[model samples]
Target: MKEIMKDLKELMMKIDKFNSQQLNMLVEHIFDISNEDDILHLIH
Candidate 1:
């Protein structure tokens, strides 16, 4: 659970670094690829 929270926090930080338009595009791309069964699969 702690590792999961850490990862989530890191992801939030990454998102926070983007401009609004880049953030929107990043989110759209994430949603598009996030259906690949597992988050770990995407990360690796």
Candidate 2:
């Protein structure tokens, strides 16, 4: 759980570093399409 949180934090930092609105919107769309279980499986 902690590892997953850590990984997610790292991923968010990387994403934020992009500083691109298009990329952010794409990521947001992906999240909107994904269910929680899908995300959990991805992190694992």
Q: Point to the candidate with the largest TM-score.
A: 2
- Listed per model in order, the count of residue pairs whose N, CA or C atoms clash below 3 Å is 0, 0
Candidate 1 residue spans exceeding 4 A from truth: 20-44
Cα lDDT, all candidates: 0.76, 0.79
**Residue pairs in clash, model 2:** none
Q: For candidate 2, lDDT tens digit of each residue in 1-44?
A: 99999999999988877768767776687698658887666557
What lDDT tens digits, residue by residue, belong to model 1 across residues 1-44?
99999999999887777667796886677788756675456557
lDDT of 2 at 9: 100
* Candidate 1 residue-wise lDDT at 16: 78
RMSD per candidate (Å) reads: 11.6, 12.2
Clashes of 1: 0
After TM-score superposition, the amount by which residue 22's alpha carbon in candidate 2 deviates from its true location, in angstroms, is 7.8
**TM-score for each prediction?**
0.42, 0.42
